[model samples]
Target: MEPAQLTAAVVSIVNTLRIILEYMQNRPKRRQHEDDFDEDVDTDVPESTGCGNWEIVVAVGLVDTVERQFWARQTSTDWWDRIVLQVWDDAQWLQNFRMLRPLSWNTVSYFPLPKMRADLTVEKRVAIALWKLATPDCYRSVRNQFGVGKSTVGAAVIQVASAIIGVLLLRVVTLGNVQVIVDGFAAMGFLNCGGVIDGTHIPILAPDHLPNQYVNHKGYFSMVLQALVDHKGRFTNINVGWLGKVHDTCIFRNSGPFEQLQEGTYFPDQKITIVDVDMPIVILGDPAYPWLLWLMKPYTGSLDSSKEQFNYRLSKCRMVVECAFGCLKAHWRCLLTRSDLSTTNIPIVISACCVLRNICESKGKMFMAGWEVEANRWHLILSTQTPG
Candidate 1:
């Protein structure tokens, strides 16, 4: 072998060794990067191959891009903390929540909501429920407005509604101030009238159980709200959750008011004589209800002049309940639309709306004129579509 040939081979071998050493030195950095992303990526990549390490790096980059996109899609501004908390105007508070802040505080004082989270205060829970009731917004929309999760908004609504039913239902809807109600009715030319009774249908989605039973003659799924309202447009008694297919008379017969009247314990023993017949303080009803001693119904077919006049007077006074129903659905727009809540929750929500309506009326909260216009428009459309 010549010296020149031996030197060339030796230099070539040294260059190869240096290249291998550099590759080994850079391997630890790549391994460290892989270890950082091992918990996030589920793929198993062999350490022996450069191709496998490249695949893991690509996967980690893709995951980071997806996370950034997801966070970008969320609203940047917190509505409750940034917008609602900054507003100090009472008008704005009422516009958003449908009641003044003071009344809302008073309501929260009656009952405490279940503590679901540290941020979900009693005031915020009540606001969430009231906003849901006053509008047709879905849970996601409400969640965005209140800066809460979608499930949290839904749970808040249920909790607040149950609270209202428990604490306010009996207190608001009862036969209190009986003489005042009777006097209000007498001014409308219906003497000895304690109140006017009527029934309205609250629209609902078809349930899985007994769907046919909830279908009314008007050809829609609903639940009946049999309510007795005073002349001042306040609900005195309400029987809710009956099937829409049930008749008003049937609901009346099974109601608490019915049992009270039958036991002769409803009124204060006040009687009035008309045509030599003594009648107790009676509630006026439409022809759909039965004529009881303590309940009066308008005359039916084949009416003479005297009977016609009697029916006109009775119906004139009965208009109060119709107006009350209109106001109830108008103020709480949730009752105007087909509710998406479960059947079990719908009754509680409806009863809560009734109680809230009575509270608003009793407290003299201003009802917007625009609400009535929209309500009448919706009612007309519903009437035409479901003629009975």
Candidate 2:
């Protein structure tokens, strides 16, 4: 063959191979996983990078900008769906119970990856946990149905409960012919009674030469929890931080109450005047309680008609606290067992649980007590006493 003809044939073959390679490279793969563009390449564009020589810089810039815009839109859509639209903007529930305070979205802003959107809201999460607490269920089951971790559910319970306790439950306003009922329970039969007084034998993996203080009067390793409940059955005050060995009266006296009495102060709001006098206020307790005028127990006088009647009403009202405690323990069976937790953390956990219980109670229908109006009456009475 002539040299010129041989060169021309080689050139043609090379061109054909190049065209086939470009077609194969640009051809669409499976369209399922990622977006695929058409195989066609504009003839005006240069071959090497499929970009025209003059358009390279602009193309790079445009690609970067488009990529950034795509990511930004995705992020905004995710936030709108999960936090704003799904959780906060639930119209029906929000209409009834609007958030008392603004949610700190900033706290979760650090979560870079978007959380999967779900049908559940924080309120729904809380309600589910409350339901579980009312009806015991395995943490695994709760987690599975809620599409949340057990730890997350527990945290939600604590967080919701804290909000209710801190914001929703009103403080004790006025004491109206106030009567108190107090009783003590024993874990292994030790006298405890300020409100729900009990000595729980928290069995620790026996420590080496543990302090005698850890051993209680029952000759067992235990701790004591003594608390005081208000007339409404709400735990108005708690007195913890006692070693298991401490007696109920001892724990109570050691608590802030004894000091307050010494200072001639009574009632939770120490500064508030009671019945026109800056005098100390009374607290109701059973005979087991120390002798204090402000602290009244059932009149031991023969269980006559008036006494029985008064006692009955007092017990009815006082039992609120007992019922509250019972409800708390029944739900968190972890509390019923000997907790291996340390002394300080125990009180904190208990307080957290109580606050959570109040949150649960707030969800259900709650009618104001008769004392609410009685309190208003006292406000008028007290206001009249003030010199205008």
Candidate 3:
């Protein structure tokens, strides 16, 4: 045959084989006999395709080999087995997931997750959620670390966060121990102080609906978290999910805590006499908030020495809330950067993080000093970057 004719014949034969293979792979299966139709019968042929018995066997073998190879490559070092399973020491456990191992296990034990797979145990689900929250990793990054699909990683994060909020939020963040908190503040030179109130912005992706409404003064899409922290840097109450454009006073006025304080129901009836004036137990706030009978703010504009001294004392007490915000963001880094979760869900996740922070604080799980340094570094970078 001529060279051109030979090449043409080979191409035609290759095309024909490609079409046949595709058809075989996609075509409907046919039963060879009545027994083949029986659901209980074992068949050599593939049930989903029209491939012959021998072809099906070969394909199954090949698939098994490829799957084994893929998993082997993914788990050669087996990060979970080598690092997580081996770390029984509490210090190392805290370093890895920002919570003591026992605390983590105990937290998840209260609300066990449904067994989705053989590998996704309740403990693993909690670990996955904590890892995602404690670091600024994307879903794909978390999947790679845990050897799960990206969708699984995302689902695990939301499920565990929801569980935390539902199970622990009320227990951990509340004013039930108001007297103890007031005493703690009194020890810090702010007599009759119950807590400190402040607001912070949590960055988030722009939503499709009214994206401009989420923009803050810094020109980034965000949500506001107005929290009241006790002297121990634990959240006693939080009002979250407000649009970033909302003012602090607006959020405070509309919060449940505001109504409680207004009715004289938030704090106890304890009071102290200062310069012949009876001062009731009150919460300290910044100048952005209204100065109610129960909410004290610093004097604005020109200040005399007495006013300045009062402001300094109030600020000193208010530092707890500022440190609480810093620690919350530092511990759960998802708050610092824009979260991949939807705008509606980010608030719940943030609330869950606050609850977890309170758990850690109340339990004496000290915040890792390194996290603050790293968080500050990232904050500087994010601040200097041009807003998008």
Return the top candidate by lDDT. Answer: 3
Best by TM-score: 3
Cα lDDT of model 3 by residue, 41-63, tens digit: 22343344344554544443434
The better candidate by TM-score, 2 or 3, is: 3
User: For residues 1-388, what per-residue lDDT tens digits would candidate 2 score against the true structure?
Assistant: 8999999999987876675556556655523312332111112322344434433433334334232111111112243346444675434222222222122121111222223237545545454444343333455555554555555555555554444445433432112222232222212121122232222333222223454776655454545555555444455555545665676677777776567655654434333354585523445455556655444456666788977865665454445555555555543443444444445444554554555444445454322234234333433443333111
Candidate 1, clashing residue pairs?
none
Poorest 10 consecutive residues by lDDT, candidate 3: 67-76
Using TM-score as the measure, name the better of candidate 1 and candidate 2. 1
Ranking by TM-score: 3, 1, 2
Model 2 Cα displacement at 269 (Å)?
Answer: 10
Candidates 1 and 2 compared by lDDT, better number:
1
- The TM-score measured for candidate 3 stands at 0.80
- Summarize candidate 1's per-residue lDDT along 14-80 as a digit string, tens digits: 8765655555555464444445542213233335454354334444343342321112124433677
Q: Cα miss at 135, model 3 (Å)?
A: 0.7
- Looking at candidate 1, what is the lDDT of residue 152? 70
Which parts of model 3 are misplaced by more than 4 Å?
A: 1-77
Candidates sorted on lDDT, descending:
3, 1, 2
Superposed by TM-score, candidate 2 places the C-alpha of residue 383 at a distance from the truth, in angstroms, of 52
